[model samples]
Target: MLIDEMLHLFYPRVCTGCHSLLAPKERGICPECIASFDAFSDADAAGYAVKEVFRRNYPASNQPESAWTLYRFHKNDRLQRVVHAMKYEGVHRLGNVFGTLLAEMIAGSTAAAAFSCIVPVPLNRLKVVERTYNQSEVIARAVAGVLRKDVCTDLVVCKNHTRPQAGLSLRERHSNVKDAFTPSGNVVPENILLVDDVLTTGSTATAVMRALESAGARQISLATVVLAA
Candidate 1:
């Protein structure tokens, strides 16, 4: 505890959202910034959104059981600022903090408890290299820490690196990640919670979902740091 306090004294951390000094209890964003987040965080609503993404991918397939996100994504907003820190500004620990909080929302719920394993959406090799870490994996581990579940990183692998999904039309986004992911041959077919940093169009998430399903996953749930409209 003393070491931690000294470290904080030497390298104070700032909230990603407002660039304010983070208090001792805060990890990524401050309490005021957190309270300022737009509140569409209902689990039921997120579950519906998850099912909707599944339907878009496989209209006839069994829909996902639960989907949960902590905040609504708005361009140039607080959520976006935190996302930028995790994805671009090299503050990857923000994902860990948020993922733990994300899991806490549904901790004991049946839908959350049913998952046999947590799988982070695999990043392409190039992106992992550029980012220095897989933000999704960092998030997934934090969630696993809270949920007491195993995080399986190898269940899915990125097969191809494509153009960034940002600014792409829906169709273009889908095309970009089409065939971008493949499940490892040793899939367990267990109930799995797929974790990601953000769900924009969900093209990437849906593609990975298809791969997981193809690999014989029994049931799937979706969790993200934020739900992008």
Candidate 2:
């Protein structure tokens, strides 16, 4: 703790959301910024926005058992800043912090216990090399830590690199990710939870889900930090 305090004196940890110096107890995001996020209410948990995204993009047969996202995302909001830091600023551990928070949100819910393992939406090899880490995998590891579940990273993978989905129309985004992923190994669990950073149009997640299903994954659900609104 003394060493940590000494480091803080020289380079204080700042809140990712607001860019303010974080209090000692805070991690990644300060309590005020966390509270200010547009979190999903209890009333919406049963019918989460991620569920709707899947329903609109994929058939009922392809949809997950359920899906949940932590916050509603807007282009220029504080939540976006947090996301930017996680994805681009090399704050890789922020993914784990958010995942732990996500686990707390669903601690006693039936959905949390339904999955046998966690599988992050994999990044293509090139992107992984470029970024030096897969943000989703970090998040999945953290979720597994909280839930005491295994994180399976070898089953599903992105075989082809695709263009960034940002600024594309939903249809174009779907086209971009189609057939971009493939399942490689033979020992895939029947029940798995797919973790990712954000849900925009649901196209990428849908594509990953299909790949997993084709490789003998019987049941798959999704959990993400934010849903684009």
lDDT by residue (130-160, candidate 2, tens digit) is 8888899899888899999999888877877
Candidate 1 per-residue lDDT over residues 10-117, each given as its tens digit: 899888888889876667778888788875557777667756766775575566667888887788887787787888777866887788888887695788778899
Candidate 2 lDDT for residue 169: 93
* lDDT, each prediction: 0.82, 0.83
Candidate No. with top lDDT: 2
The TM-score that candidate 2 achieves is 0.94
The list of candidate 1 runs beyond 4 A from truth reads 53-62
TM-score of each: 0.93, 0.94
* Stretch of 10 with least lDDT, candidate 2: 41-50
Candidate 2 at residue 123, lDDT?
88
lDDT score, candidate 2, position 51: 85
